[model samples]
Target: MNREILVENLIEFLPILYKKFFKGLDVCEITKQQFELLYCVGQWDEKPMTYYCSKMLVSKSNLSIIADRLIEEGFLERNTLPEDRRVILLRLSEKGRGFLCDQTNKFKKEIINKLEKFDENDIKRLNEIMQEAREIVTKLD
Candidate 1:
């Protein structure tokens, strides 16, 4: 396999896919970065701040700034681990979960609209392909 071509295609395809399906969707009042943070927390609830910094490839200070805004907005909660008071953990509040659900629904609807031209068979095949792709990609981690 041509690994260079595969890398180049992924680099080009990912942004295009994101732009078509996720970019510019209504995220209530939060910035895109804030929404992404919320999504990450929603997916990995009750994780330490360091986890987010590592997963998102952001600095601790930058993650703190984003977390602070989300906390003030009532979408996230910060807590200290009972066993380790110095470790700060983040989780989504009820409001954050609801907001994330709503945003996800909106994104799904947009993607559905874009896929309307595809026949049922094509859609099914696409779903299968995507699942296979996901399984293959997860090996990178």
Candidate 2:
């Protein structure tokens, strides 16, 4: 496929996939942006605010606002680098980890419910296809 066609297909497919299988699964009190920030922080250990700014494609000031809210809610904690007291790092608090875990399990259950019509063989094939797709997509990074 041509690059343009491939890009268009991805633009179409991604939202369809999310809406079908992942949308509304996060039945939490946080806003979508907050959830996204939590998800990004959950992926790694302590990271500086700058790291999150780049990863979330938000400005430093915006990222700080989200971080402050999460910190206030006890879902995240901020600590200054010991060596360079100026650099701030963020990490998930115990509550944040628990929330992320619960959210993940909820998503798994929802996905399983949606796949109930598929037989074992179909499910296995789907998993294989997804794994292959992930491997190929990761190469783009």
Among these predictions, the greatest lDDT belongs to 1
Residue 44 of model 2: what lDDT? 70
Cα lDDT tens digits, model 2, 1-141, are 698998999999999999988887766778778988898999976999999888889999999999999999999999999999889999999999999889878878989999998999999998998999999988965
Tens digits of lDDT, candidate 1, 53-113: 8888899999999999999999999999999999999999999999999988888888889
Q: Which ten residues in a row have the lowest lDDT in candidate 1?
A: 19-28
lDDT of 2 at 112: 92
List per-prediction Cα lDDT, in the order shown. Answer: 0.91, 0.90
Stretches off by above 4 angstroms in model 2 are: none
